[model samples]
Target chain A: MHVLVLGSGQLARMMSLAGAPLNITMSAYDVTTDRVVHPLTQAVIDQTLDQAIAAADVITAEFEHIPHDILAICDKSGKFLPSTDAIKAGGDRRLEKALLDNSGVKNATYYVINNRADFDAAIQHVGIPMVLKSALGGYDGKGQWRLKDSTQVDTIWQEMQECLNGSAQQAIVAEQFVAFDREVSLVGARSASGEVAVYPLAENIHVNGVLSLSTAIDAPELQEQAKQMFTAVANSLDYVGVLAIEFFDVNGELLVNEIAPRVHNSGHWTQQGAEVCQFENHVRAVCGLPLGSTKLVRETAMINILGEDTLPTELLAMEGCHIHWYGKGKRPGRKMGHINVTADYSGELQRKLCEIAGYLDAKAFPAVHEVAQKIRS
Target chain B: MHVLVLGSGQLARMMSLAGAPLNITMSAYDVTTDRVVHPLTQAVIDQTLDQAIAAADVITAEFEHIPHDILAICDKSGKFLPSTDAIKAGGDRRLEKALLDNSGVKNATYYVINNRADFDAAIQHVGIPMVLKSALGGYDGKGQWRLKDSTQVDTIWQEMQECLNGSAQQAIVAEQFVAFDREVSLVGARSASGEVAVYPLAENIHVNGVLSLSTAIDAPELQEQAKQMFTAVANSLDYVGVLAIEFFDVNGELLVNEIAPRVHNSGHWTQQGAEVCQFENHVRAVCGLPLGSTKLVRETAMINILGEDTLPTELLAMEGCHIHWYGKGKRPGRKMGHINVTADYSGELQRKLCEIAGYLDAKAFPAVHEVAQKIRS
Candidate 1:
C-alpha cells in the first residue's frame, strides 16, 4: 500500500523510514513547492496534485498547517485519514473546545472572542490570569498572550491588536489559567478495524514554550487513563490514524491542553523506546494494515536540539545517547534535531538528561560554572 | 563522519536509517551496478570504486562475501574495519577452524579433508557419528553430509564425491558430533576507543539448520564465560564493529560454532528491543562515534521470513509483532523479511510466536490430536 504525507520534512523522512521496510511506499506532498517527492528520496512523486492524490491509498498531514487546497484535493479523492473535520477541530481552539465539550471531555475553561469588546467581556467573566489564543496559526506559544493584570491589559490589548495586522476583527479564544505541576502527552493510533493501541504516557518539558525533552515511563494508571481518553476521542470522531493529546497535570487532575491530529513531537522518543514507532503505526493505521506494538523498552529521554548553533562534537562521542539531526538548516527556536538517551535504570535517565543539557549549554550547570570560576580563580 | 558499506541490502538499508538521524552520511557500494547509492537513497555516493574508497571515512561490509578486489582497495586505504583477515576467517569454514585452533578457542573437534580416502580416515579418527561439510560457500545445512554408520560410509563418500563434481579435489571438513542442548549467540561491538559492550546473550533455535527464532535472556555463568572468550577474541583481533559469535550449548559447556564479522540475522530483534540497533551501533563504532545503549526493553523473539512463498500476511495482524519485508525478489530459501515480536511479559512473545509459526504452516501443528481413544458406547 502507498501512503502520501502532506508535509515534506524530517517527520515525513522518518515516516518513510518506518514505512519502507513494510514495502509501503511513502510519498510526500510538498505543500510549499506543490510538488511531490518520496519522503526520503527513494522515489520522485512529482505528479500533478490530483494525480498524486489519486495514486495514494491514504493521505495524511505531517503538520496542521497543510494547504487547504491540497486537503480539498485529498477530500475529493476520499483518501484523507482522521478526516478534514477532525483536522479543522484541532486547528481551531474554538472548534476544538466545542468538540471536547460536546464529547464530555475535560479541558481548561475557555470562551471564544471576535473583537476587543468580546475580549473585554471574556476578561470580565473569566477574569485576569487567563490566556488569549488565536483560533488558528498558533504554536510554540506564538499567537498566545498571557494577561497578568488590569494595569497591563491595555498595553497587551494594543499589542494583540498590532498582531491582528489591520483586521478589524480576528477570531481568538480565552482560557482560564491552570497551575499544572507537569505536562504529559498520550500518543495513540486507531486502525480502521477500531483496534486502538496507546503508547505509554510521555512526560514532557518545554523551554520557551517549545518542546525540549520527553521521557516515556511505565505508569499503569496513567496508561489506563490515557488509553481510555484516546479511545473515547478516537471512537467519537471515528479517527483512523495516530493522534496525540497534550494533558496538564493539575494536582493529579488531567486537563486536556490540546490535541494534535497527527504524529506528534513528544512521541519522537518512541523511535528508540517503543516496539513500534508512532510513524510506523500511523502508516499502518492509514494504509489499512494492522496496528503494531506500542510497548516501551526502557526509560527513554529525547532532547530536542533546537536552534542548532552546532552541537559539541564531544557530546556526540558520549555513550548511550544517539544523535538525530534533522537535515534542516538552523534557525533560532526551530527544531533541527534531537538526541535520544536510553537507560536500563531510571536514575541513569536523569544523568543523561543533565549530561545532554550540560553539553548543549555549559554555563547552564554548576560544573560548567565551576570551570568558569576556576578560569577566573 | 562518513561511513561506506560494501553491500546494498537490508543490513545496509538499516545502517543508513541509523546513520541518517546522526547526519552521518552512509553510502553503499552496489556490486551489481558498480555504483554507490546512499544506503537509503538519501545521498548519491561516488560512482568509481577508487573515489568511493578515497571519500569514505571508514569502510565496512554488511556481508563477509564482499568482492576481494574492493576489500583489497579498502585495506590499502588503511580505512577498512574488522580487517580483511577477520572476514576471510569468517567466510571459509576451514580458515575459521584454523583460526579457532590458533586462538586456542574451544570448538568441535574437526579435520580438513581433500579426498574420499581422507574423508574416510577423518571419519575413522573423529568417529562414525560425524558430519562432513564443504569448506566454502556453505550455510544453513547446504554442502553438508552426515555419516551414520561404517557400512554406509563408502556409499556416502561416493555420493559426496559426485556432489563435489570433478574439481581435482574439493575441500571439506569432518567433525565429531557433540550433543548440544541449545544454541546461543553473543553480539558485541568494539569501538576505536577500545570500549566494548556486549548485548545480553541471545538464546537461538534453528529449524532445518536455519535460524527460525531467537530471544534475549540473561546468560548463565557458563554463557558469561563464553562471552568473555568472545571479548578476548574481539580485542585480540582489534575488531571495531559488531560481531556475532554462535555457540553450541553441550550439556552445560559452551563451545564455539562460528563467527560472523558483520551484523547477523539473529541480532534483528535489536531493531525494536534495544536503544540502538546492531546495524546502527556497528556504523557508529566504525565512524568513531560513541556506542549506544544496549539494554533490552523486554524479551523479544525474531522470526525470519524465509522464501516468498512462505511469506505470511496473517502474521502482520497479530499484536506486538512487527513485520519487515526486504523488498527483494523472493526465491526459494531466500530471506525476504522477518518479524520481531516483543512484550513486557514472556507469554506474549510465545503467543505471537505460535501465531506466526501457525500462519506459516497450519499442518505443522495438529489442529486436534487425541492421545487416547476409548472404545465407548
Candidate 2:
C-alpha cells in the first residue's frame, strides 16, 4: 500500500523506514513547499504533488499542523485516517480542552480568552500563576506566556494582544499551574476497525519546553489510568492511527497535559524498547492491518540530540546506545537526532543516561543531567 | 558520510535503513542497469553514475558476487572495505578452501578436480558418497551435485564436463559428505582499528539448501569455538566489516562449511534480538565508527518468506513477530521477505515459531513444520 504523509519530517522518515519491510510504500508532501519528497531519504522526488497523491492508497499526517486546504483535498479522497476533525482538535487547544471535558478526563482547569472581558474572567476562574498560551500555532513552549504574579499579568496580556492583533482568530487558553511530581506520556494506536493498543507510560523530562528524555515507567496504577484516558479519547474521536497523550503525574494522580495526533517524540524509545515501535503501529493502524504487540522488552531511555552538528563518536561505542540522526542540517534548538539506550535494569539505564550526558553539554542538557543526578542519588 | 554499495538488493536496502540513523547516505548501483538506486526505497536516482560515485565517501558491497571490473573501480578509490581480495576469496570456493586450510580450520576433506586426471584423483581421495560443487557461480544448492554411490559418479562428471567445456576455468571441488547434527552460523565484525565483536551463535536449519529459520543458541562451548573460528579467519584476512561463517555440528564438534563476507541470512534475527544489528555493525566497521554492543536482548527465531505473493494479515497481530518485505516480484525460489519473532524464553520462542508456521504452507515449508513439531513435542 502507498501511504501519503502530510509532512516531510523525521517522524515521516522513520514511519517510511518501518513501513518498507511490510511492503508499505510511503510518499510524503513537504508542507512548506507542497512538493513531494521520498519519505525514507527525504530526497526531493522528481514528481508533482498530483502524481504523488494519485499513487497513495491511504493518507495520514506526520504532524497536526498540515494546512486546512491540503487536508480538505485528502478528506475528499476519503482515504485520510483519524479524520480531519481529530487533527484540528489536536492542533487547537480550545477544541482539545472541550474534548477532554466531554470525555470526563481530568486536566488542569482552564479558560479561553478572546478579549479583555474573557481575560478578566480567565484570571478570576483560573487564578494566578497560570500559563497563557495561544490556542493555535504553539509547540515546544513557543507562543506561550507564564504568569507568576498579578504584577506581570498585564504585560503578558499586552504581549498576547499584540501578537494576535491581525490574526483571524484572537484566542488564548489560560491553564492553572499544575505542580506535578513528574511528567509522563502514553502513546497508543487505534485501528480503523476499532482495535486499540497502548504502550506503557513513559516518564518524560522537557528542557526549555523541548523533550529532553523519556524512560518507560512501570507504574501499574498510573498505567491503567492512562490506558483508560487514551481509550476514552480515541473511542470518542473515532480515531485511527497513533495518538500520544502527555500527562502530569501529581502525587500519583494523573492530569492531561496535551495530546499529539501522530507518532510522537516521547514515544521514540519504543523503537528500541518495545516489540513494535509506534511508527510501525501507526502504519499498521492506518493501512487497515492488525496492530502489532506493544509489549516493552527492555528498560529504555531516549535522549534527544538537539541542535548539535556533531556527536562524539565514542557515544556509539557505549553499550546499549543507538543513535538516530535525522540527516537534517543542524539549527539552534532544532532536534537534529536522538539516541536510545536500553538496559535490563533501571539502575543500568540510569548509568547509561549519565554516560550519554557526559558526551553532551551539561548546561545545554540540564534536564538530562538532572535526571541522571536524581537517579544517581 | 555517503556510502556507495555495489549491489542493489534487499541486503543493500536494509544496510541503508540501518545507516540512515547514523547520518550515512547510501547510494546503490543496480548491477543490471548500471544505474543508481536509492538503497532504502529502491527509487532510481536522476543523477549520473559518476556523480553518485564522486559523492560517496566510501564504497562497499552488499554481496560477494560483484563483477570484477566494478570491483576494480572501487578498489582504485582506496575506500572499499573488506578489500576486493577478501570478496574474491569468498566468491571462489578454491581460494576459500585454501584459506581454511592455511588457517588450520577443520572443513570437510575435499579435493579440486580441474581435468580428467584430477577427477580420478578426487574420486580416489574423496571416495564415493561425496559432494561435487562448482568452484564458481553457485549458491543455494545450485551448481552442485551429490554422489550417493559410484553408479552416479560418471553421469554427474559427464554433466559437469559438458557445462564447463567452453568455460575458461574448468574446475570443481569434491568433498566427503558430512553427517551433521545441526547447521549453525556465527556472524561477527572486525573494525579497521582491529576491534572485533561477535554475536551469539545462531542455530540454523535449511530446507532445499535455502535457510528457512535460525535461533540464537546459548551453548557457551560451541559459541566459544565459533568465535575462535571467526576471529582466526577475520584476523588472518585482515577483514573489516561483518563476516558470517557457516558450520556443521557433527557429534558436538564444529566443522567449517562456508564463509560469507557480508551480513548473512542467518543473522537477520539480530534486528530485534540484539542491542545492535549486523547491518548497523557492518556500517560501523566500514565507516570508522566504534562498534556497538552485540549483546543479545531476547531469544529470537527468524523465518524466511520465500516466493509467496501474499502473507496473512493476521500474522502482524502475532505477539513479537516482525516482518521484513523486500518489495521484490514473486518468482519461484526468490526470497521475498522474512519474519522475526523474539521471546523472553526458549519455550515461548518455539511456540511463536509454531504460530508463524501455521500461516505458511505445510508442504512447501516442511522445515518450519518439522521444527514446530519438534518444539511442540
Candidate 3:
C-alpha cells in the first residue's frame, strides 16, 4: 500500500520506517518546501501534491499545522484519514476547546479573544493567573503568555495584540489555569472500523515548555481516566489514526491539556516497548487495516534528544537503550532524536534511566537529570 | 553515515530499515541490473556504482553471491567490511570447509570433486549415502543431490557433471551425511574493536532445504557450546560484522554445517525477541559503532512466509504476532516475507505459534502447522 503523508519531518520519516515492514511504502509532502519527497531519504520526487494525492491509496498528516488549502485538496481526494476536521481542531485552539466541550471531555475553561474588549471580557470570565495561547499558530511555548496579575495584563496584551495582528484567522485563547500534579498523555489508534486500542499512559516531563522525557507508567487509575477521555475525543471526531491527548493530572482527575491528531513524541517508546508501535499503528489505522495490539511489551521510558545530535558511545552498549536519530541537521532545542530505554520491570527501567542520566549532560538533559534525582530521592 | 550495500534484496532493505534509526543512510548496488538503488524503495539512483562507492563511508554486502569483479572494485575502495575473502568463503563450499577446518570448529568430513575420477575418488573416500553440493552459487536447496545407494550414482553424477560444466571454478563437494537431532544457528557480531556479542541460539526447521521456522531456545548447554564455536569462528575470520553459523546438533554436540557471511534468515526472530537485531548489529559493526546488547527480551519464533503475500486479517489483532513483508513479487516457494511471534515466556510463545497455525493455511505454512500439530498431539 502507498501512503502519502502531508509533512516531511521526523514523524513522517519514522512512519515510513515503521510502515515498510508491513509492506506500506510512504512518501511525504514537505510543507516547508512544497515538494513531494521520500521521507527517509529526503530526496525530492518530481511529483506535485496533486499527483501524490492521486497516487496515494491513503493520505494522512504527520502534523496538524498544515496549510488549509492543501488540506482541503487532500480531503477532496477522499483518501485523507482521521478527517481534516480533526487536523483543524488540533491546529486551532478554539475549535479544540469547543470540540472537547461538545465531546464532554474535561478541558481547561477558555474564551477566545479577537480584540481588546474581548480580552477584557475573557479576563473577567476566566479570572487571573490565566494561560494565554494564540489560537491559530502558537506551539512549543511560542506566542504565549501568563497573566499572573492585573498589573501585567496591559503589557501581555501588547504582545498578544501583535500575535493577533499576524493573521485575521488568529486570536488569543485565555484559559483558566488549572494547577496540575503531573503531566501525562494517552496515545491511541482508532481504526476506520471504530475499533480503538490505547497504549499505557506515559508520564511526560517538560523542560522550558518543550517535552523532554516520557515514561510509560503503570498508573491504572490515571490510565482509565485518560483512555475514557481519549475514546470520547476520538469517537467524537470520528477519528481514524493515531491520536495523542496530553492530560494535566490535577489531584487524581485528568483534564485534557492538548490534543495532537497524529503520532506523537510521547508514544515513541512503543518502537521498543509496545506490542505494535504508534507509527506502524498510525499507518495501519489510516490505511483501513485492523488496529494492532497496543499492549505494553516492556517497562520503558523515552528521553527526547533535544538540541544534541550525538550520545555517549557507552550508552549504545547499555542493554535496553535504543537510540533513534531524526537524520536532520542540528539546531538549538530541536527534536534531534530520542533514546528509548526499556526494562523487564519498572524498577529496572528507573535504574536504566539513572544510568542514562549519568552519561547525559545535566544542562542538555535536564529532564532526565530531574527524573533520575527524583528516582534516587 | 552512509553505507553502500551489495545486493538490493530484502536483507539490504532490512539493513536500511535498521540503520535509519541510528542515522545511518543506505544505498544498494543491485548486482543483477548493475544499478545503484535505494534498498527499501528499489528506486534506481542516478549515480553509478563507482560514485556510490566513492560516496559511502562504509561498504558492505547483504548477500555473499556477488560478482567477483564488483567485489574487487568494492574491496579496492578500502571501505568493504568483513573482507571479500570471507564473502568468497561463504559462497564456495570448498573454501568454507577449509575455513571451518582452519577455525578448528567441528564440521562434517568432506571431499571436493572436479571430474568423474574425482567423483569416484570421493565415493571411495566419503562412501555411499552422502550429500553432494555445488562448490558455488547454490542456495535454498538448489544444485544438490543425494546418493542413497550405489545404484543411483550414475544418474546423480550426470546432473553433477552438468553443474560442473557451468563454470570452470564450479565443482561438486561430497560429504558424509550426519543424521542430526536438530539444526540450530548462532548469529553474532564482531566489532571493529573486536567486541563480540551473540544472541541465544535459535533452533531452525527447514522444509525442502529452505528455512521454514526458527525459534529462540533456552537451552543453556547448547547456548554455551554454540557461543564457544561462534567466538572461535568469528575470531578466526577476524570478522567485523554480523555472521551466522549453521550447526547440525548431533545428540547435543554441534557440528558446523554452513556459515552465512551476513545476516541470516534464522535471526529474523531477533527483530522482536532480542535487543538490537542482527541487521542493526551488522550495521553498527561495519560502521565501527558500538555493538548493541544482544540480550533476549522476549521468547520468540519466526515463521517464514514462503510464496505468499497477504495473511489472515485476524492475525493482526493477535497479541505477540508481528508480520513483516519483504515487498517482493511472489513465486513458488519464494521467500516473500516472515512472521515474528513473541511472548513473555516460552509457553506463551508456543501457544501463540499454535494459534497462528490455526489461522494460516497448512500447505502454505507447513512448518508452523507441523510444529503446532506436534505441540497439540
Please, what is the TM-score per model?
Answer: 0.87, 0.98, 0.99
Q: iRMS for model 3? A: 0.8
Best by lDDT: 3
Candidate 2 lDDT over B22-78, as tens digits, reads 989899988779899888777888766667778888888888877788888888878
| lDDT of predicted model 2 | 0.88
Per residue, candidate 2 scores C-alpha lDDT tens digits across A39-96 of: 7677787777667778899989999877788888888888898789899888899999
Q: How many backbone clashes does candidate 3 have?
A: 0
Q: Give the candidate order by descending TM-score.
A: 3, 2, 1
- Mark the 10 consecutive residues where model 3 chain B has the least summed lDDT: B344-353
Model 1, span A1-377: residue lDDT tens: 78888888988888888887798777888887878887765345559778878888888888886656667878888889978877877887888888777777789888787768988898987888998888777888888888888887888778777766644444778888888998999999998889998999998877667787687877777677767777878888898889999998777677789988999999998887776889999988888877877877667877777777467766666656777787777786678887777777787766666666556674222232232344344
Model 1 has a DockQ score of: 0.43
Docking quality (DockQ) of candidate 2: 0.89
**Candidate 1, pairs of clashing residues:** none
Q: B1-377 in candidate 1: lDDT tens per residue?
A: 67878888888888877777877767788877788887764345536878888888888998886666778888999999978888877877888888777767789989888877788689768987888887766778788888878887888778677756745444778888877898888888889878887787888867668786677777668657777778777876788899899988887688888888889888998887775789878987888777876777677877777776335556666666777777677787677888787777776665556555556643221210110011110
The superposed Cα distance between candidate 3 and the true structure at residue A98, in angstroms, equals 0.3
TM-score of chain B of 2: 0.97
Docking class of 3: high
Candidate 2's C-alpha runs over 4 A off are B47-49
- Return the TM-scores of chain A for each candidate in numbered order: 0.92, 0.98, 0.99
Q: Which ten residues in a row have the lowest lDDT in candidate 3 chain A?
A: A136-145
In model 1, how large is the Cα lDDT of residue A255?
79
